[model samples]
Target: MPQPYQTQAATGGGKDQEPTIIIGIDFGTNNHCSDKEKVPSAIYYNEKGEVSWGYSVPEKASPLKFEWFKLCLLDEGDIPQNLRNAAQVEAAQKSLRESNKRVVDVISDYLRELWKHTTRNIRRAIGGQLVDLSRFKVIATIPAIWPAYAQIRMLEAIEKAGILEPRIAGETILEFLSEPEAAALATINDMHTYSPTNMEAGDHFVVCDAGGGTVDVITYTVTKTDPIRVKESVKGEGKLCGATFLDEVFQTTLRRKLDKISPDAWQILEENGALSRIIHNDWENGIKPQFRNTDQHWLLQMPTSGLNRKRTHDQFRFSDIKFDAKDVQNIFKPTVAEIETLVTDQAKTTKEKYKKEPKFLVLVGGFGRQPFLYTRLDDQLNRKKDQTEKTEVLQGSGAEPWTAVCRGAVIRGLELSEDTIESTSRKPNTVVSTHHESITHGFKNDFVKPFKTMKTEFIYSTVTTPPERCDETVKRLCKVRWSSVPDFNSLPTWINPIGKVVRRINYDVKMKSNGVTLDFEVMYKNRVMASKKIGIDYTCCGSAVNQFHDSDEDSGDD
Candidate 1:
């Protein structure tokens, strides 16, 4: 028998070292997964302070249970207006306050559990000897529409969860790819059924990742097909119209109907877990995915104690509530409409840029697997009576819909590690550097001249044509600062004409872009003094800084 959870290699080094193993983690709002299997994103804490997470969580709602906590990571202003008043969000927030935990802390705890299970599964598949001896590389997926600050918080949570412990900095042990990009990679690489075998180099396709909490859309134009290379045709767009919101709407509808029939019964159901069972077990697992505009009626059984009591309403004759096809359609209308709008907008943008519709619209994610959603989009895109050109809609194959993002992340990690050539390789979207500058500052002894710290600021504008000079449209992105300079005292000093000792230092400010992120570095004589990465927010032009220093100064000039 093989030993379980035993340490093998101290460090992965040398030519004979084991190959790096790629692990992809899709940290979703409703569920989290590493491979084909997924666990609920819910977490529960007992009175003794012990915690349970994922699949171990109870099916019914509990006061100690925390669900939809992922959305709490967004600032108040960033949350969708409709979701602001959602009961699930309120419950999660209450749980956080009761537990005295921050959103990042909760997420970190949950990720720790996910990592343990993922590694255990890997060990079981490949055996302990190979697993312990090999190095691990993680590729995590994030929402495309998340702001820079949110992404930073996610990274902090991932770091706190100890997922990056095996590898040192600058070794590419961990990387984050946008959800839609990952979905596209999985769909194109693994789904031979929908993969465009005849797709030409200039052909374009759109990927719509409709998950449990967010729906993200992006268009990619193929540059090569032999080894599969593509680039973003337009910036991606996303919204909070996911499957959970549909559940929220359904629950709201049920409550309204119940209140009208019997307020006392509604209260009793809420006090118990009957309402939760109906929503989670009956509607979510059964009705939502199967409803496809068919004329079918669903009779949901209600608790006999309160609902069976005699009432004036004729529909209350039986201890059940009836939901017709129209009722289900109403529950799905608002959320599905939002998703349709997002996909349509992406299609329009792709057409504007490429002068033709995308050849295919590939759908991937847990929500994307819904037959109703696929049928709706198929009819709208391909069967429209007013349009002469139609775009084909394809569901991702070769991997479970919910696992596509994680699988694609693993595929990307493998590609990056194997591709050795400088050119003719699949790479991330090109990020062009727009600005560069060099600044020299002199500090006199009279003005605190130790040169212990230095600061740099990055500013950006979203306007198509930015003003030549800094204006109201320009916003500060982030600030990068470095302290405890090792060579500060070695700098040559001279006496100024005013008889004050002066020290001057010159450094270059360089900006580098990686995917949707921008990195700024202050370099002194080929040595990195300070560096910071800022994620680009495609949704709006707002001030979001990932500052490296605590102090806030207007300028770096002295």
Candidate 2:
């Protein structure tokens, strides 16, 4: 039902065709951003059946408001139990029940609105008909610890939202990058500038993406210095402890104190939506960011008349409730401790693997900039007496901390496009072809022995749990064979430790999506050596394996 757009090289579009543009989207639980500026991840449906979202949502609480719906994409078991009872989650669940909409539908609706704004912003920046004529390559960031199914659901929502609606299958590529990876890409350069230790190849660093609804931590080992390529040192870990939890804690504490002083005042505020307004305006926007462990005081004015009961306490006046440094610190303690634990664990993992602490611990995200959070992490993690032994704590430079993930997503897309262009330029004379869908899984092999033929067996399984080996649940999909082998004498050779000459030919077996079927290709040095298309009896599900082996020994006919 979706309309297909023309590819960059499609006929009829002449010299007026614009170059492809890359866009990065970070869809967070508390906020969403396509660029440097973020909008709150809140949506509201008015009584008149009109919808408003993000910054347009009303300041007053409404029964139709929806927040924290992003986590609803995950299976119930995947969500942390503590977050299940959060106010935003409860409101979203209620909204879904009343509207008879699924989580994907809600997500799609929000994304559709976001895309509209993103396109407008793009047109304003570049001008002309560039937006319509240019092919778009979108890189969306997802939490590093999200399961594969959640990632797939996110892709589906993006497609349904019309972001990829007018897309020519493989031409308009939509790729997913881990949030920590994206954040690292955007902030690592800044880290290099501020870090005391000189960053170099093989040096490891940890990226802690402490956002609104989740804190994800990952360790990366730098592979290249110039262009900055890194490989994951360990599997990333994450928890539901984020800045939003601080808001909840503060609100809960306020409610408890208010009820103890005057239950009538608390009831009046709740009924009139004054409580929600105070939390959003005074706490979330003001006190949460400004808290710095110093003895500072904050006053929240009570808007209801029921608070005129003349309550006299050091922390409370007749018309307002007072919050001191200790009150805000208490609200931040649990959440900050959780984040500290996550970062410490990642540092410990890196130390165990590489025999030293991470060279730097880079923090990025909306919450990553909080003075209290950064101060606590630095004090706890970098307390080493020797400066060289300490892991340098670096905050994302200015607003870079807030937009790092989305910006990093764009950087990743550009890198991929550059790689593609570079590869094509190297083999200008060769006819390069791409399948309808992008490659998903690929395996590389090195050959030291000469062979006339090579055969690869493709196997698949539908079981929920992956098999350790090719067992009963695993079925053979098909076999691809390369019959005419390239010349071994022309390939490069290297000497082994035993002084034996070895010819090493590296090739990758890549599988591309083609609706219900799959197209497989065996590539050698970026050149397609062999390819095969196979039909599928089942939809694309579960895991796959490509077993490679030589079909025949060297004939010695050379």
Candidate 3:
């Protein structure tokens, strides 16, 4: 069932809820984006106040591009050195720590920069009249592999990014859609629009999202055709087998080749900007996607800027560098095997539900678009006994494979609004499932404080204000009251004990009441970051009011 926004106002008898602008943000490990628009998941810094992110961050230049920054967000350690940026995330962490910032903080900063550009682009694409930030809605895509804790922290970053409306007023609703699931939604919609063969009712398929950071797999069983309904048939699976790993392999191969010539030459190549440029140019256009088997060798020309023809053997006649097919196979085999494992596992696990096996496997993501990788997956599955049937293994048809995740997310955002409209248009018994988990977040006030006989003072601060007050009583009529003076809506999420605002917070609160029901949430920084609320009710004490407690006063900075 759609989790009620718990908008305290929704219960107050809304004939119809107002609609908001919908946008989807695909925050990938290697690529971050807003709908169809994308930018790199990178940040660059040279001095204390000098920083840039995404495409703006210069590569193969004097500045620093924080590589594999998103990988550091993972809980596990033992991260491959090649994947950990040339300057290293350790240095980035150290620099950020000096400024009282953490990984999420840096990530949020990058996202904020992206958000500003996105809104501007939206206005240019549409119009300022239709593209209003005040009514913005953002849906973020997360890897299914991210545990609950990681997702919560990602949510914290998403909140800090300033796109989400922090207060609950139906003005802003933020959703977290799984990466593979979002891709699945896009696939289904495309299939519907194009009317692909056997995209029939009851068809089961798996969506494999092979992005630059992680490989995530999700299996879905379609239930409806006219409106195109599907449910996740099995728990999603993922591994750290993304396109970034291939880049790491390429780096390792280059290092080995350079080392064969002379240690000094390899060190210079690694330290200077030359190697990165060669890798970037080759991966984006050359050998990375084109390499199919181990019979061929790839030769790269080193930058000519700082080289002597004789100092570094035949390996460096100003530019010649070589790695054979065996090296390429070694680099890709492990990562490719890992992805193949995930897809196979999802298919096997979903067999009981789908009866035979998944009818199709839809691959989507930047890495998923690789022709060689797709062939490998097809071969792997075909060799398996269960996949003897002619199950289709394909990428998205209507759009580039990389855009599916974001496009699907946007479609989902639209569907959310559409569902609300459809439900409102008809009666309660219409064709809609009440047991759907379509909602992204659900808030409940699990924490309650009991009141005694005397009226107690309660201070309440919403995402929009400093603090407000109302008498504690068993029964009362209430709503979130705003100040006439109008405090800024962009208030910091947390305040110091002395009550000084530190940073700007873009958050929302949803409060509802029959007789004074205060339902809302606020974020507090603890270097860590559910949905819980506060409730107040009278506890029977007869005449001995002094013996009973007025409130369950237990709280901490979270």
Candidate 4:
């Protein structure tokens, strides 16, 4: 049973009120660091079948530790689904389904371990016995652009992991939020520390959350600062362009070099996991954050244990290989371009729709602090420095960039607990800081027309595959951006928009296996913003049509 905490608000005798701990699990694709607010997302399964998480899990414990498991849900078709490789992934996929392993099942296993271990460190965080689960509030940040079902699946996974009981009727102990949105809340509240210029009400800015797996951008104009709140100024944009893609480019370049040295060496390197170890180690330590030099080339050392015992750089043993400036540039060029495109797209849309440009572009997430990345984006997006043109790109100082999402999540959970306390029968006179009431919420900007409209129910196309049950139907929601005013008389079952379609969030429950899946496409002028699989009886929380709220739909960008 989920019961509100009886804190100082309930009984104001003790100096220390048992804190409502907000534990944010950053379930990253490459790393899972929650015990200390950040850790390698790697999980290892031992021979006895017990699981060990965080990078500290012994290397010898498992020959193949699961990394990039989060990437399995991407289904973008650009990246390979089988991160562990084709053969191993194939067998595991079969075993996974047969064993009833959903994606969240693997995620839950890691989080369950994290939850059990967090108790040891909870005293240092907020100081309270960690016996009861209800004493704490847990929040897991999801990528802003993930499908609605993915969010639901994450909650389901959390409940299954024994962190919280699955809530069917009311508000559960856990809640879902966009990673970028969480970062924005963190940034806006902490503007005094990060922003160059203090932002005022009605001042607009963009939040660019660049992480290992995705880059999510959403523009907002400050609506109020009496406990900060804002309105969505533009449709948020999320791209697959992230830090891991740069690692992929580096991997490709490394493989190309390795193949030239000796194909056998590359094969042996793969078999022994030497190449991967070298690639990630070199990238993370040697090149990634510190690769700021554009003029000079650096050298990358090869693993001494691999089959190609002989180093290729100078035909000497145990020597370093040349990774020239060109090689580094080649590895970064494509990813950098993708990032520029996303930022520029947001900027262009901001200018086009709002008539006034944004004042700041706040970058947060693991990759947000990359100097090279910051330099390029600042050079491109920050076109002005003087008061007239003040838009500049900013990142968190110190560890703020990497930990903003989780920190913001913590702030959110704390606030929720405070609200719960205030609502109690016996409320203590506890004064909270003005910043404590930072509540950020908004309805999705629904698309509507000004002219006369005809209303009709749209039935989706039927499926041809075998039905799992007699009355099974999947609802697919599509986010669309329209290029021009669409003809309501002849609406296309699928959306065909003319403008920038930010993202089309498709649910992972494969439409191929099911016989009857209803595809619900949500359109904004020229873009398909979101799509998802839903049961036949699923209801929508927001609508695309409204007479009273239609005026607010036009973004107040300036």
Candidate 5:
């Protein structure tokens, strides 16, 4: 018979701890659910208006709501007026001020509540077949290019929610990773499962994680050995253009229309919570709205007879609004254009710089979930094809896109928590002393001096030496600006070698509004050598790049 539980002496010297069970949390705008549980991120308000949080409770007769508390923590500056009535504003402020709460706090609270519900539900559902929540480790998938402040906020939230604690009933350390990287890992795993073909390392592929809030794309080159040298891949971020932008367009169009109407009615709609509910309901119910920019007219599919459905004394109308496909396309123009620009720019750069063409663009996210969105992208990619035939878009679903990131993150968590993979994260050893703006002296001149450098102190262990070859392929967990560059010459003699031309990498890392973190790799002798970590102050936003140095002692080859 299988032992119910096994105990082994701890490898790191402490008493044996419980085996870690990794749990992935995808904190989305709509709801929070794990791959292993039915619990959702939701809450309800009672008759007296007192709020109670959990999944739908039957005895309370309260309606199911997802992300109720999370929406309360958004930066007031980022929220539109329609989303912020006087009451909501107050509630938001209250939530924001509590423990210096930030976006992650809201996410953590929502997640903690979800976990609570999961435990309860499992116990009730299957007579406690599921393990308790305390034994599980959390792996959260965050934005690709988050600001440092935002990252700290998320960390603080995780800490407060007890994800960082080792208590029996509390969560262990939270493993936060980039959502795009996680998705790429998932794709790689998927490929491994389906295609057993022998692969080589340095094989490159572009990963696109298009979700509700952002479309995160990265180019990853697999690093593996001969006969199977495809373990490692190159990854790069495209841009962030997700479903939230669509909602913004719809909301803006509606807001403009509402602005033309009487403010009193608008206020009533806003105050009564009808506006948010209507938009939310519409989006959830698959009702798309279109707008004519020139005429300022909205084409909605609503009953002409139920025009007064907002009145207190009117008969109930069965219908709401209707949106045409064209209007949907128009509203999504900006977002679509943004993605197109990114793809074109990335494809052009890869061809010119790396001499490689991406065969496919994997589109996994909530926005990518839309079939029409994929069609739009296909049209754009085909229009811009440069004898490369076509840039295919591999799309996923809304119901799964958001969660896929978390799912991928969990796999990473399990790998990390089990000590199978070592974290090669480091702090920045340099600082930027001078800032120079790119200057094009001549009109229509396409020339650009688009790179910057920083001053940092290097830390090196006696046994660890910088890679002999270019560090371009070695990935590290560092916090540098997406477009920021680091001068390899800046490394102290103790860490880097002399007289070899070092390679510099310029990337526009995708980070959440909270904070910035970079995960990059170095390529040396057909293998990864070392990884670095650098912490950036969250407030500053600028271009970041890495430079190489060759000392006089080893010069003359170039």
Candidate 6:
């Protein structure tokens, strides 16, 4: 039943309120949400001069190609190494700015078109009801590796969308859930369908999510105790080592081929239609139907017919290019080796900690969709399992790894609504200043005499001066204001006493100087304290002071 959106009281009591449309937007550079419940990371312009998605563009249409455009914008540096054309590069730069224009701009314009096309079936399947666009809660999934500052920027962009207007529900409103967690959840849901009590205590489950930008892993121990908890022990994380990386490798291979065959035509293709973008788009789609068959002739499909006539390039044009699967294998060997090593190491680390062999390893993501990838993974895991009898490799469809993550996030969100922390029954998992002032310095042997103990006020000054410079000393004092009394005596006296309060603290300290530097250390009336050294640098004057000391001077000479 579709319900209206409403806010729940902080006390946790709420009725059967309307289910505000909860939309999960997975902003992968290679994929975007295309439908109500489906998102493909691709965008295409249609014949109507409008945008379309998840489909090939028609020849009659004036199309603008966008693949992993969201991820492209995150880069503050030059364009990707694969792209070298001045014109296409300029166009891509312009598209990136347009894609990021306004959150709503993308949504209402390009994204909405994709959504309408893709979600037509989903909406029909779901009882012929349409989403209440006026009041939907938008939840986006972001890469966990993004810096804290970057995550905040994404949130700010979403807020500017004006969709979550008026009373925004905290946590439940707009949130960024980790991608792998969502994928793991989706996998668990599938696994549970067959065996409700399948994963048991001490059973280890390894999850690999290979997406547009990164490959992330999460290993967990499944327990069948009362609540059936799954606890995460480790997270294998890295940037999109998936299709995008492969695109780069393929482009380099083509570039080398072009150089060998015809450099003149290569320059033309470089200017007009670089095969890099086409390969990148194809790779991101999780299929290279042509690349799969080594014996068959794969089309380079460049824009110019004149250049095609002159270029008898190896892979650049269909000039009876005779390259075997071995050639493609050799080209991708580095990336394949890297992927294998990362997965193997992550699995080994988890297995070592578990003591027992892992029962199942679940692979998900765009890269996981490759039949070849599955074969390779299976072989690797089988070899490892050969040494031990307990381990097994369980295979799932690679076509939709993100589904698990989205389902899991939704389930998790529902769990939060009921005030339950653990959904062990549903899935096999257990998921989980101030400164002081005041300073005292003491010197030993010979040089220690001008002032046994030196102290200055004004905390946080690290300037030093000569002993004769009394005029250089500056005093700093701070007043106290508190609703309640603070225990200043309990605080350490070694630090210059400021003032104390029940709720806060304040302090003032002197600075450090040469020949017995004055280091101002302070303790506030409250619980706050800090130290600052105001003194002259003796190194400039050739004095070798091992440590600086604070001087107690009312004033210091300039």
lDDT: which candidate is best?
2
Q: Please report how far candidate 1 places residue 289 from its true position, in Å.
A: 1.5
Please report the TM-score between candidate 4 and the true structure.
Answer: 0.60
Top candidate on TM-score is: 1
Candidate 3 C-alpha lDDT tens digits along 1-558: 011111111223443434345566777766775445445788876677577887777755432446455655643332334434434456544555555656777777777887787777767766665444235555676665443334556766777988675534344656666667667776777776686567876677888988777677877777777667777666666666788778877787778777776666666765655666677676556888777784887777765335444334445434477778888788888889888888988877877665667888998877777777888888876776645566679874323332333333232221121111011101221121111222221211211222121111222211111212221211111122221111233333455467754433222332222111123332223211112233332223111223334343432011
Q: Which stretches of candidate 2 lie over 4 Å from their true place?
A: 1-20, 34-37, 44-50, 55-66, 76-100, 124-130, 167-172, 192-197, 270-277, 304-317, 384-388, 401-467, 470-509, 512-558
Error of 2 at 424 (Å): 34
Rank candidates by lDDT, best first. Answer: 2, 1, 3, 4, 6, 5
Q: Give the TM-score of candidate 1.
A: 0.70
Q: Write the per-residue lDDT of candidate 5 for residues 272-334, one digit (tens) a residue.
A: 556656675665345432222233333332222233455442342223343455556677788
Residue-wise C-alpha lDDT for candidate 6, range 98-180, written one tens digit per residue: 54443224433444554345335445544333342223455466654332223444554455544344643233355555566
TM-scores for the candidates: 0.70, 0.67, 0.62, 0.60, 0.52, 0.53
Error of 6 at 384 (Å): 4.1
RMSD of each: 8.9, 11.3, 14.5, 16.0, 14.9, 15.7
The per-model lDDT (C-alpha) reads: 0.64, 0.66, 0.55, 0.53, 0.43, 0.44
Tell me model 3's lDDT, rounded to 2 decimals.
0.55
Per-residue lDDT tens digits for candidate 1, residues 316-434, read 33367888999999988888888888888788887787788788888888788787888878776666576666788887433443233333223222111111111001121122232
Q: Point out the worst 10-residue segment of candidate 5 by lDDT.
A: 438-447
Evaluation by TM-score, superior candidate among 4 and 5: 4
Q: Estimate the lDDT of model 5.
A: 0.43
